[model samples]
Target: MSSNALDQFLNENLEDLRSKGLYNEIDVVESANGPVIKIGGKELINLSSNNYLGLATDELLKEVAINAINEWGVGAGAVRTINGTLDIHTQLEKTLAKFKGTEAAIAYQSGFNCNMAAISAVMDKNDAILSDELNHASIIDGCRLSKAKIIRVNHSDMDDLRKKAKEAKESGLYNKIMVITDGVFSMDGDIANLPGIIEIAEEFDLITYVDDAHGSGVTGKGAGTVKHFGLADKVDFQIGTLSKAIGVVGGYVAGKKNLIDWLKVRSRPFLFSTAVTPADAVAATKAIEILMSSTELNDRLWENGNYLKNGLKQLGFNIGESETPITPCIIGEEKTTQLFSKRLYEEGVYAKSIVFPTVPQGTGRVRNMPTAAHTKEMLDQAISIYEKVGKEMGLI
Candidate 1:
């Protein structure tokens, strides 16, 4: 028999979650997660993927991945410091540096691992990290791991950030001060005020770090938030993911040569964890090439976002204030949000409900992620379905 104490604890916790309607019921996708996805044998207008450029199903990437498997096999075989670090790994890093317009770049197993690796690689208990209030969870975990003095500045509040930065610099308490934020605030799709944040960092001599996971293939014509604001040379640490927009499986940090060199020698994950597969590395490199070569996909993405946003607003739904393709239809109550999402799925759209504590209490929403691959016809049908469901649920 299983341990009685452990089983009781787990069962009690699960029951509590279920009673509070907090337990997430995951859906099984029966096919590729593209603009359209099949789930439970039913197709949907899938609006819940981070595949912003729709590169996950791109023929070029698949072909390159298959060829890479043929040439380099399935895995890297060992930790990077041991027998890994294949040629594709090096080439991918070089291409990423060029793509981000940085002096150098380093790769990691995942975006979360990149943060865990980079933050602690540079900081320690004696240092401080001034982070945005709404920065991603990975950032929070990284800061905690470093044992850094974390000062959370008000979200997107320049005055608050400036004040905190000044106080932290004058405290004479920490060895180093770093200002970290997401390039794009994931939930609301609001672009970070990088120009303002960077100016404060410069004044306080704080290291500037931007995690551009969501913004990499969605902003700055697919270059990212720093390049979007034309401050590529000013930021100290630029972290991004190969998984989301790149449609592969890894993460990276691009910065000055010294930082990259230091991370290579110092980051625990890089030394201990095995490198990404050859297929992932090469496919990520090719995706970067596509983004660097043209703006067609980027343009299409923006166009789809605008179309959907306008359609939602016209139908009387409160989409909140978003400047990116990530959209949210606020449904207020947690149960209401879940019901709305369930009804929407039954009606053919595959948008997902995000409730507390992914968001704050009573601010639950059905998030929509429109991609470059969605056609006009698909969007129009989705909009009509939203109208029908919104009326049935009295959301509109």
Candidate 2:
């Protein structure tokens, strides 16, 4: 294709995004992403970060990262299949497996890449995958890359999943069948029906995959959704990220030893891409250790989440049914949702607007991530802002 043709296509797509009100304007976060952040020279109570445990700014994690840098230097020189598998990497994986109560674990450079690597590595063109309709974008892309026939079941609808699983298995149209879902749906903050899904998977003998990105740090007593329901051994593939609850950057899959071994050899990101930095690996390992030691952070996180959710509900905002630390104040229109977010920013809260394509068209929301570090004072201040902005916009 000519360069001008490609340019025209790109321009048209950009215009389409703008017309749909889906073009995101990037904000420059001037400080570390924490409970409070500086953006555009204005400080605001940040409710948009994934640092659920507040580990990103934790002195312990920072000290560990710095010490690792001093000891191991800055980067891993090559991919894990090459010379990049440092001792810290193995330690982190082992620590993760222990933390998650799995036999083994394999780490990827990022949570998104973990999906891209693990999904395609295990399931191929001759397979069929039954996925949740509300799964993360990474799960969708990973399913596509697998070249499997993707069947999206209704969000958390056990009957639909069971029906599809049976149909896929009976058809014999593929070599394998797998069911995948996000343990906690990020947008709605609702927990997946994993216990029901596990029962269906057992009935159909289907491979099981759960991306517990949101649930890892927030649910199941800090182990995750699998542990929450005592389905650890029942689920085949358990995926999580070090970035969210662990307060670092990286992703992992924990399961049987064979599965981790298989991913180490077959997952493209593990085999081909440069590995995570020594600092990141070491820091993530320490974070896991902290999580294993106590449920203090997790307890605080839930308390704050409940406080915020109750406050929003009492103020008459439509806070969705969330079972985790994630809370969403649903507004039905894209323009209104964006305006609401803008008003919150002006009033000094930093929750961002999530709109169509991310969620369904009419389910636009301002998702709030209440962390362990948020104090009662902070929660009160945020609720006050939410009420003021919501009332001003006639949303409450």
What pairs collide in candidate 1?
A: none
Which stretches of model 1 miss by more than 4 angstroms?
A: none
Worst 10 residues of 1 by lDDT: 15-24
Model 1: per-residue Cα lDDT over 1-396, one tens digit each = 899999999999999878877789999999998999999999999999999999999999999999999999999998888889999999999999999999999999999999999999999999999999899999999999999999999999999999999998899999999999999988889999999998999899999999999999999999999999999999999999999989998999999999999999999899999999999999999999999999999999999999999999999999989999999998888988899999999999999999888888999899999999999999999999999999998888
Give the C-alpha lDDT of model 1: 0.95
- When summed lDDT is taken over every stretch of 10 residues in candidate 2, the lowest stretch is 387-396
Backbone N/Cα/C clashes per model? 0, 0
lDDT score at residue 105, model 1, on the 0-100 scale: 99
Candidate topping lDDT: 1
Give the TM-scores of the predictions, in the order they appear.
0.99, 0.98
Could you give me the TM-score of model 2 versus the true structure?
Answer: 0.98
